[model samples]
Structure formats: structure tokens, C-alpha cells
Target: MKSRFVTGTLVFMLVFGMTLAASAEVTLRHWDWHQPRMNIKLKYMAEYEALNPNVTFDTQVIGWDDYWTRLMSGVAGGDVPDIAQFHNSQTQAFLNHLEAFPADVFDYDRYKEEIINFEAAYLFDGTFHFYPVGIMSGLIFYNADYWEAAGLTEADIPKTWDDFVEIAKLLTKYDSAGDIQVAGFVPNGILGVFWLDLHYQLGGTLYGEGAKTVAWNNPAGIQALELIESMIFEDRVSEVGFLGFNEAMGTGHAGMAYSWSWLGGELDNNYPDLNWGVFRLPTFDGKLAPGPVARNNHETGMSVMRSVRQENKDAAFEFLRWLYEDTDYLIEVNLVLGTAPSNRTLLDDPRIAASPLISAIAEQVPYTNIPGEIPHEVENDYGLGMLQDLLFFGYPAADALATAEAEANSVLMERAVKWYVEDLYTPVTD
Candidate 1:
């Protein structure tokens, strides 16, 4: 059953004149980061069904931990669904599984400004792979009570790493037995995004255009690592990996934690008693490091399976346009799933415009930078997690970055070599 049959009535709303059959049924299997939350995914599916009356959306959600694995397997086995959400990082692997089309994919030029001013991570030689959803950027969340206890007001938030160190020091408190009661900061989790952004702020580039090599050994990289090290070692202002990032942020164990805006709702909902607010990460020498952009900052997007028949392919993409470009559908995503719509035109939708959490994220759109556009996949792999765990175990900053860089480059080089051997690409080493 093709989805067109199930969604026949909705065709009336489309500018096109084709009407689907009443019994035309297509099951759209869409994959995303989390198993769709009860109220959220169901609400959208119900709305889509009501509008179309002919299509059925069968959503197969994988958790963040299992998403990549499930997606990669499906792709490799050619068992991918009608559509699935993909991260900007996962675009390469999934692109090989997507159907190609003529240039005009929803008038890309018309939404040029909405392209999110960073290097398009999903582009492989200018062939756009995924339809971006929403924006995600780094934010520094502070426990206001802790800052006030340290005799600092919201006005005292630092603008530089140096100033932040001072504030962190002031906020750190210890019990008589020498156990740290409250840490000035927590430095893991999404703070990893801060790693690349801060490297640029510290004056380093991961890759140079002419040379397809990793350049993390530069001075800026050293400085960035040193800054994180200073907070844990010299200043004793942070509890690196003593607890999970969420736990630290929620329980008031940390004064500040670098996280995404989406966490604001989680904090407000779960920790109802915690007094906190969000701010952009501090800058260096008065210049702010641009925040990293994600495919969707809050909620993700779906892509069609390359193996689906051409007609089904068209149907999948048509549904995608309706799901993403349609204002009503986009608003439903925001309202039901806590997603900030990526459709530039939806910025005015009262549903999204009214959310202060989503709006705060919207405010940072001008500062978003997509992470490295290199084709190799990045594995969170507990490197930051392990490094933070070992911070208290006395690992030096240089040693930590050196070890992590070596491992990271090893993984990346392996992939690069594989792609080269397969004639998919080549490295430009100088």
C-alpha cells in the first residue's frame, strides 16, 4: 500500500492536482534519534493521517546510542525504510542509500538564507544529502543560586576563558574535610562541541584546504586543551567526569555546564527547584567562538531509502515536503515534540515564536558553525568521558589531548584510507 492512497484527501491541500486513491496505502517507516515520545510522534502521525487520510506513518525510533548502528546496518543491508532522520555527521553513510534527484529540491535558492551560514556538513562536493531540520548550538547554563552565593550576579558572567576561570574559582566551594561540595563548572558532554569552536577561538584549524590532514597539533589546539586542564587541575573549579552531565546540571553539583538549549526544558521539568539560566559560552580576547550547528538542534529529520521504487521515492519526498515545508506540519512538530522548526518561514509561527527556550536557540542561529565537514564519522566513544574521568586521576592536559588526538586521527585515517581504496575519495597531503 503506497502512502498516497492513505493520504488522498491531503492532496487537496497541495498545489498539485493529483488525488490519491482511497485505498492507496503506503507505510512510511521513519527513523529518528529517540523512540518518538508518546504524545509527540503520535500527535504528528495523527495530524498527518487526518490531513492525508491515505498515508500511514510507521515510525521506528532508535535511541541515540543505538541509532547510528541501526541506521548503518539498514543501509548496508538495503533494508532502510521509506524515510529516516539523519545527523549532519551521518549524512555520508546514508547518502549512498538515498535516491538522487534533479536540482530543484523545494526551491533551495528561495530559502538560501535558511541554509545556516556554516559549511554545509552534508554536502559531498556540493550535492546536498539531507534536508536540515532545526538549529543546535552550545550554551553555558549556570545555577544562579551558586553564582549568587559566590557574590556574583548574572551581570558578572565572563566573556573570556580567563575571566571564566576567575568566576569559576570564586564559585567553587569545599567542605572542611576537603571534599568539593559544589564545582564551578562541568566540562564534558556537549562541551565537546565547545572543543572545536574554542579551538578556532584559540586560533587553530582542524584541516587546511590544500592539505587534507588533521591540524590539531597546532598552538591553538594546545591552548584550548590547556584551558580545560586549567579548570580541572590548577583552578580546581570543575568536576570533570565525577558524575553524568545531566546529573551535575540537575542536582546543583556544578555551577555551570556547557549544554544545548534543549536541556533548559529538561531542567525546568525535572529539577523544578533549581534556579538557573542560560548564556553563550565565554569568548576569548573579546571575540566569541561561533557555536557548532547540528542538523537539527532539538528534533531530527527523515530521508528516503534509495531502494524504494521511483514512485514510492516520489511519494516519500512529497511527504517530506509536506512534513517539513508545510507551516502547519512544522508547527505540529514544534508543539508535540519540543522541536524548533528549521523552515525559515516558520519563524513567525506563533507556536514556535512563543517558546522562550526555542527562541533563545533561535537567537544563536547567527553564530552557528557546523563541525568538521570531513566525511569520517565522529564517535563520542567516551573519549571526553574517559578523559574527564581521569582528570581527577591526574592526567596532564597535553597528555590527554595527545592521546585523544592520536586515537581520533587513527579512526579518521582508517576511514579515509578505506574511501581512497574504494576510489570514493583521496587525501590531499602536503
Candidate 2:
């Protein structure tokens, strides 16, 4: 077997062919919302600059909530950074403003096999836009101590929705005034994504008529909504009108939560004393589904903007090529974020495979799914907003889902017109 360094060197040569001599100095502006990984980015940038002394990076770290607004503003003004973070959700919204990865410079065909879920994660309109670094999948994190307290063990972990609800009920605790002291579960923490997962597990579809219409108003959707309602209301295992449920879980006030892989890192860093275990989301039945149980892919990637100069774009691509080929860098950055590395080769690294929590996250990578290319804001406005109503205001699941479906259909219609009609009407200047 080849050593790790030898393997990395071989991969590096296969990715970026014959290094060219640096001529003119170029400063590429790089932007990302992963503020937590700022130091890692800087470290990599320094190393990259050392490799090509003429190429430098101007890195900017923005907050997640404000990143979109800033990105949109930059896009409108034709001033986006040379390289920036690209979310799977925002791909449809900024498709026109982004630059497709040049096939000549980046050997996508060769590299695709090295990355996990490459086809599902980043391909759009027969073009690739981003270099995916890691993926964040939904996971059920339970406090092992709380599980033991409830007289449960690894063997007692839930295999079906019903079993999970039962386990949640047993783990719940109440205060003197009949208020919950410890929540058994927290479905509201990942409401929209969880709902989509449940919908798919129950054999539901989100799109209809060739993605031009919404089809989530069917029986499967209704059942998914009703289940969430029951969890928050009838079962009372999960508290209604509660936020920070994940934090509560970390503090031992909540027994279980349906959260993304990042929670594993958070627990490791913030609640080191808390014993936690992770499991894949239980299915509707007691069996694990053969494929993905969800529609949302929380994978994030880096992309070059169309507005950047060709020289700068080339520089940016060089850095990206090195970043993706460097297995150590990819693994380290992913470990910091508590996510599974998009580079499939690093998935089974000794460090990741040794840790049960990280290993559990890596296991779900193959079964993860990406959402349809819909406008990102539509889900937040129609899907998540309506679900919140059912949870906090006691709206009937049927009524809430119907209203949400109607609103979502309208949004889809608008998107259809923009893509099929309005875009055609606008003349292509280039």
C-alpha cells in the first residue's frame, strides 16, 4: 500500500497539471461565511501563496445571516469576490452570476470520483459550479447518560418513528408545575429539513409536472406534518414554543435532538463532559431505507464568480485545486466544522473512523439527498414558516400544509417565468 504522503502527491499531480512559472502578481479576493474556519482558510492561503509567490488572497469572513445579502449586492453590482463560498440552496438563485468550473483547468471528470455524492451535490444544467469540501447531514444526537437513566442502551435505539416517539416519551421529565424540565426530543430544531426527510421516508414527492408545480399536499405530506404536531402537542415529548433545543440537549435538559453533523463538533468542544451518541434518522417503518430519506443537501462548496478577471480566476482555481487535493487540509477543515469531508478518500481516515460520532456522520453521507433546484428563500418562507405556525400557534397540519403548498406553488410559478420567459426576454450582452 502507498503511504499517505505518496498518495497525496500522486493526487496533486493528477489534479493540477504542469506548474507554470508565476509572471504578474495577482491578488484574488476570497469570501466565505464560515467564520469559524477563518484560521484554516488563512493557513491554507499562506501555504498556497508560498507555492506561487505571485498569487495572493484577500480573505473576508462574513456572518451567515448577512452573507447572502452581501453576496447578492455584490452580484448586482458585478463586484463579487474572485472566489467565494457557494451553498447548494443558493445555486439556483445565483446561477447566472456564477462562473462554471472550466473543464480544461479543472479535470472535473477525474476528480468527480474522488468526491462523495458529486453528481447529487453540485451538478446543475450540465455544468459544475462549485468545488464541494464537506457535507452536513441530519442526524439524531442523544445524550447517552440520559439514555442510561431511562434504562435504555445502544440496542434500544429507535428503528422506526413509533419507536423513537416511545423512547422520547420515556426520557422526558416534568417540573413541579407540569412544565417540561427535560425535553425528550426536539423536532422543531431542524423543522423544515426534518419534515422533508419524513415526507420522503413515507414515500412523498415535493415536485410535480416536471418541477413546475408543488406536490407536497398529498397524504404523505399530511402524515409528516401530523406526526410533528403530535410530537409537540399530543405526545408532549417535545416542548412547544421552545428554541435552542440543541443547546438544551447539550446541557442535559433535552435528551434527544434531530440536528446536522455540526452538532457532533459542538458537543465535543462545548460539552465535553456530556456523553452523546448519534444515529441516522429513523424511518417510517422499522427498517432503514435503501436510499436517501431527505430532499435537502446541506453541503457547502467554493465557487469562482463570473465577474472576476481571467488571471485572477486562474489563480483562484489553482488554490482550489490544491485545496481539494490536499487530503490533510480537507480532513482537518472538516474535523473543525464537525462535517464529513466531501473528498471521499478522507472519509475513512483513521482519525475520523476511530471516533464513533464522526464515523456516524460519514456513514450517512452516501444516503444523503440534495433538494430540487428551487429558490432558497421559498422553502424558508413557505415550508418552514408554515411549519412554525403548526408548532407554535397550533394550526391544523392539514390547513397549514395546504396553505404552504399553495404559497410554494405560486413561488415556483414565478421562478418558472423568470427562468423560461424573463431570462429569454433579456438580451445576452456577452
Candidate 3:
């Protein structure tokens, strides 16, 4: 058996086309946060190992909250995985330590032409360190049992918000004591994001002239807030102080939920017994969906490490090239992770049209706006987070919206991200 050796870094000598001794084996370590996705990766990695005959893997899954912190520590200690799974939003935290895709090896122009919103996956500085595999955006997720008990079917999927409100009333369940048991439509924790979804549908802007700060206090935005108010307060189909967005949906206490695509995987992982269905967030015009319907962010990335030895770096990228370029793997990632594949080629594949969750996401791909990562404070505290203040405390929607606008602008102006974004699709096809 070949023995391990080190010079400046641990040398695996696993370069492409290099002959390996029969007994010599190398392990490539990879780290990610999501268990559902990692399951898919592990399956493929097993196949990769079989084909190579001398490669094995050390796969690690960390919780989302502590992943970055742990990764940062690993980098500083000079003990890091050869490949790190990351979200595009977390790039600035680790970009300097990531190896850029070699210029001559991969066709950059083909990536641009073949991938949807390719630019959003990379930095504005023009060097590509991370490549996003797919995108996650807002969708309407409903409990199928509740839907059927309410005498509803897929034919009842709404063309507009007005139709959706009527359906929400049907899905809501009231107990014998006359208290809400199952809310028809619970925005609870997700109120902020779906609110932005509606605001964009109504032609509102998140920032002002030069994109320096927030400008969400306009007529369209206030109208969107008022609509939310009517649904929660006037229609009586939803309630405040209910379980949070994920809890309600996963536990079957919410008849319908407005959340991102990842909720599908979460529900699958945590609540496998749930009977759920998905539809695109309804349009405002009662016609085809139009531009700027929802805000989306990049998801699922693999970064080759700058710290790995030269031979290991070459091996890692070679494996990654196979992973990213493989259409079957691309399709499977979206299926398991509930994301829309970034590969434009997948759009025409029959598999893309088969999965309801992925199809909903793919249909809206043309209409999404990626305005970088929204300031967390604005999304959770100052802006969309103000829904409770309005509904529970009776704060006036217009005035509260104005205050939120001011606070969001303050936060946006101070944020490090430049706020420019890419638009990939709007519901133009079937």
C-alpha cells in the first residue's frame, strides 16, 4: 500500500489521468448543511467512487445556523474540506478562500448561455468562485386532505388573488367552540416574503432611483399590504399568534401556506405523512402571470477549495465538472431540493414538466427578480416583520407601511450588497 506524504499540504496525488497503485486510495471530504440534499449527493458520490475504483468520501452535514461559523473556524485552522456546499448569499464570507473555476477548462460562454441567471451565481467582480445549481422562490403549498375535505380539487386552483381568497375561506376549519382550528391561509412567519411577492406583482419597487435605499411606501405597495390585511382580518380565514409558517404547514394545522420551494423538501423530510400539493402564487390580473412576480435567491453551490493541494484541486474540479454538467444529476437536485434547475436545457426535458413542485418553480423562473440578498433586518424586523403590529395591535396599514419604508431604507443604505439583480423568466409559456 502507498503511504501518505506531505510537503506544504497533504498530497493525495489524485490528479486526472494519473495512474494509481492498486492499493492506494484517496478520500475527498465535502461539507453541506441540508440533509435532504446531502442524501442525493451521497448517492451520486457512491457511483462516482465506483467508477474511479480508488476514491472515497468523507461527507459531513452541519446545521444551517452553525455551518458558516464552523466553516470559518476550519479555514482559519488550515483544516478544511476539499469541497464546500454553499448558498450564493454566503459568498462574501468565503469567496477569498475558494478556488476560481480555471479559465481555459470550462467554457464560460456555454455556462452563460446554458444556465438561467448564471450571473447571479457569481460575483460582480467577474471571477467565478461559486456556481449555483438551482433557484428557490415563493409558491403556494396546501394540505391536500384539507383541500379535499373542503370539496376542492386541482381544478379550483386560482387564477387571481380574489379567487384564492374564496378558496381560503373554504379550507379554513372552525371547531365546535367557534375558534379557528385550521387556518385557511396562514402567512404567520412567512407574511413578509409573500407580502413582497404581492408588492412586486403590483409593480412596486424595493429601492429608489439609484438603487441605494428602500422605496416601498408607494401606492402599489400599500395596496398589497391592505390586501393582506383584508385576507387576515376581514376575510377571517387566517389568524395571528398561530403556529409559525413551517410548523403550521408541517403539522397539518394550516390548510394553505405561502412559502419558498424548500418547504417541499422540509415537509418531505420532517412530515412524510403530509398530503400536500403546490400551485403557482396566483396572478393579480386574472390573466397570465407577468414580470416581477416573486423575489428569488440562488441555492445549492459547490466551491473547490483554494487550500487543497494542486493535485487535489484538479481532482476536485474534475469531479465537480462531472457533477454540474450531468443533466440527470441536475434534474435530481431540483426534484429532491424543490428548486428550479439552472440549466436551461432541463426546461425542455419531460422530467421538468412531470414534477408539480418543480414545474411551478420552472414556470415562474422567467418572472423572478434576484435583488441580491435582502437585508435580514429589513425582511424580518423593519419591513415584512411589521405584519403583527398591523393586524394584532390595530396599527393602520398605511402609516405602519410608511414607517417600515423609512426603516428599511435606513438599513438598505447601510448594507454592503449593491442590490442589483437578474430577472430570468416570467410566465410566458404553458
Q: What's the lDDT for all of these models?
A: 0.61, 0.75, 0.79
Quick one: ranking by lDDT, best first?
Answer: 3, 2, 1
- 270-333 in candidate 1: lDDT tens per residue? 8999988766667676443233222223244566778876666777777767656666655665
Name the 10 consecutive residues with the lowest summed lDDT in model 1.
417-426
Candidate 1 local Cα displacement, residue 10, angstroms: 29
Question: Model 3, stretches more than 4 Å misplaced?
Answer: 1-26, 389-391, 422-430
The reply for model 2, stretches above 4 Å from the true place, is 1-21, 266-274, 417-430
For all predicted structures, in order, the TM-scores are: 0.78, 0.85, 0.88
| lDDT of predicted model 2 | 0.75
Could you tell which candidate, 2 or 3, scores higher by lDDT? 3
Comparing 1 and 3 on lDDT, the stronger one: 3
Per-residue alpha-carbon lDDT of candidate 2 for residues 1-430, written as tens digits (9 for 90 to 100): 4698899998898665544333578898988887767788888889888987888888898888899899999988887899988876676678787888888877778667887656655666657888777777778889898999888988998878999999999988999999988889987656766787788677666666566776677888889988988887888987766646578878888889988878887888788898988887787766544545654354566888988898888888877877877787777777788777777788879987876766777776665555546665456876555666555676677777777788888887777612221111111121
In terms of TM-score, which candidate is stronger, 1 or 2?
2
How much RMSD separates candidate 2 from the native structure?
10.1
Best prediction by lDDT: 3
